[model samples]
Target: MPYEVQGVVSRAKGEPVSLETVIVPDPGPGEAVVSVKACGVCHTDLHYREGGINDEFPFLLGHEAAGYVEQVGPGVTDLAPGDFVILNWRAVCGTCRACRRGRPWYCFNSHNANQSMTLADGTRLTPALGIGAFLEKTLVHAGQCTKVSPEAEPAVAGLLGCGVMAGLGAALNTGAVGRGDTVAVIGCGGVGDAAIAGSYLAGARTIIAVDTDDRKLEWAKGFGATHTINSRGLGQNDVVQAIRELTDSFGADVVIDAVGRPETWKQAFYARDLAGTLVLVGVPTPDMRLDDMPLIDFFARGGSLKSSWYGDCLPSRDFPMLIDLYLQGRLPLEKFVTERISVDGVERAFERMHKGEVLRSVVEFS
Candidate 1:
């Protein structure tokens, strides 16, 4: 039997999302139905609402979520009803070229449930990030479910499903930040702060946080940033010089652009040492493009230039480990949840997020 749930839906571009009757069908083969526990109100949700992601209107908004398995469909063996889980969009197919090469995090072919949820009129709804979670329940591929320790709070744990995971992965996996290295993270939002935490955890000696907002920069310090730069009125060269001067005239060993503008991207490129790495974890609008930077700089940079996909994380591997860290008084995951909100409050949360007033306004299901 199908279930009718109150869900947040974006029916048109540049319009506010609203409560709708979303019909969630029973799990099909290789799929599972999850009773969503908590879903973080992420920016990506707002992006979909604004048609920034694609023309896939009537999007089922929300993704970064933690839930429990309510039902498992045919051919599902790894998960069963009652299991606590965090939903991940990347359900890697082991046969994909990247997976075959043992880099499932870079899986060439990830998957979602074959069945689609719909409106009362039978119009298909595109699930945001293929894991629409801002409702009572959601359906996803079985592989999208990652089991975590029961001790983890749903709101905190669900964050690893997206932004937080992306930030941590940028430092630990992509930038490969290590002991005594200097790391400068541009944009001290949720993702930037996570990168700061990751850098500190990875033993980075000096973590420099740069952002136009003094509030965000102050928050970055709580996440272990050793220094901060408020680039509000500063020019690109001044910001670059300020960052470079912090690291004995070379530059940071790694520079991460949590703000994905062409200027920030270029700033990140120029703000790194000759052999340093730069990680881009920020999402840009479709209209944003970059072609001004000289092509030779890519060759001269001498190290990695990478885009962090969900922090290049393997959910099954990182989820439990991060949960354990959260339990042990390390990896203060709770900090990410700036405020708790009801599902209906998501639209307001998006507005607050846009104003940079919150790190994560999580929708905690009752």
Candidate 2:
């Protein structure tokens, strides 16, 4: 039977999201119904509200989430009711070409609930990132649910579903920031700050954080940034030179563009040392272009330039281990939850996110 639940929904482009009666269907084959406990308000949710992602209106707008499985459809052998899990978008399809090559993290064909959740009028809803959890109950693919330590707070654990995971993966997996590697992360928002934290955890010697916001830069320091650069009112050369100056005049070994603008990406291109890796984890809009004559620079740079999709992370592996680390007091997962609000507060939370008032505004169901 389909269940009608109150959920945050963006009904049209540039329209405010409202709590609507969302029709969540019973789990079909390979699907599960999650009793969502908590979900984080991420920038992507804002993107959906603003029509920045796509024309997929009436989007069920929350993804970074954690909850417990309430029911599992037939053929779902691994997960059962009462299992605690973090919802992830990248539910790897084992048969994808990338998965066949043994790199499931790069699975081209990801999984979502086969059946559609709908509105009261039966208009199908596009669940954000395929694991919409702003609702009290959400339907998702069984593979999209990664079980983790139930002891972990749902608010903290949920962030691993998206932004935090993306940032951490940018450093640890894509950038490969190893011991003693000098790292510079542009934009000290939640994502960039996570890169800073990841770099610090990976033993980065000189961690430099660049952002226009001093408050965010201060937040970066808490995440173990050894140096902070206020990039506002400064030219690209100035920011690049500043980072170079901080890292023995050569430049950082890894430069991460967490801002995702063309200018920010170009700064990452020039702010790294010879043979240094550059990781672009920020989500750019469709219209943002990288034009100009930089053919010689791409060759002269002599390093890998990578785009980090969902931090190039494998949820099955990362979520559990990260939960353990968080429980062990090794990872500061709690720091990500800047504020906790109820589902009704998500629209205001989006405003807060736009103004950079919080790292993560989580919706707690309780």
Candidate 3:
């Protein structure tokens, strides 16, 4: 039987989300039903609520989640009922060119639930990131579930489902930060701080964190930032100069632009040592452009300028490893959860997120 549950839904653009009845169908072929325990409030969910993603109205808005498998549909052998898992947006199809090339992280064709969840009136609801989970239960493609150690708390482990993963992956995977490297992360929010943590874990010799907000900079310190720069009143060159000064008159080996604006990206481009890498992990609006940048700069600066899609992560491989690290206390994953909230508090959580008051406000199911 289909399950009817109360889920947070964005009925229209820019309007506050509300608790609505969501109809989640039983797992069909290659799908699974998960009993969601906790889901994080991320900036991406706020973007969806504001119509930044699309015109897909009435979005079932939550994706950064961890849960137990309640049921599995036909042909799903890897997971079974009671398996603890983190939900991932990208479910790689092995036949895709990227997957065939052994780079499934870049899989062009990812999977979501084959069936749609709906509102009480039978209107189809678009699940946020194809895994609407800000509720008691969710439906997803079987491949979307990545099993991990059950010892980690739901609120902490669920973060690997999105933002935290993006940050860690940006530094470790995309940037290829290594031991004794100098790294700088721009925009010290949850993602930027995660980058700092990743850099620390990778044995980066110096980690510089840049942000306009002092509070976030302090938060960065806890994540292992070796230096902090308040760039609020500084020009782009000034910010770049501060980073260079901190890195022994040379720029960092890797500079990550977690802000995603053209100005921040430019700073990151100039603040890297010659032939150093620049990783862009932040999400930008569609209308944002970089037409003014001189083409010669790209040629003059000889290094990789890469955009990290979900930190270029392979869920099946990364999620379990990260969970184990968290369990062993090697990774401070629990620090990311600023507060635990009831599902109804999500709208308020969005307000606090905009104000930069919390790293994450997770909705915990009773």
TM-score winner, 1 or 2: 2
Candidate 2 regions with alpha-carbon error over 4 angstroms: none
lDDT for every model? 0.93, 0.94, 0.95
What is the TM-score of each predicted model, taking all chains together?
0.98, 0.98, 0.99
Listing every candidate in turn, what is its Cα RMSD in Å to the true structure after a full C-alpha superposition?
1.1, 0.9, 0.7
Q: Candidate 3 — what's its lDDT? A: 0.95
Per-residue lDDT of candidate 2, residues 260-299 (tens digit): 9999999999999999999999988888999894799989
Model 1: residue 32 alpha-carbon error in angstroms: 0.6
Cα displacement (angstroms), candidate 1, residue 1, comes to: 1.8
Q: Candidate 3's error at 352, in angstroms?
A: 0.3
Best by lDDT, which number?
Answer: 3
- Writing each residue's lDDT as its tens digit, candidate 3 over 1-366 gives 999999999999999899999999999999999999999999999999999999989899999999999999999999999999999999999999999999999999999999999998999999999999999999999999999999889999999999999999999999999999999999998999999999999999999999999999999999999999999999989999999999998899999999899899999999999899999999988888887788888899799999999999999999999899888888899989999999999999999999999999999996
Which residue pairs of candidate 2 clash?
none
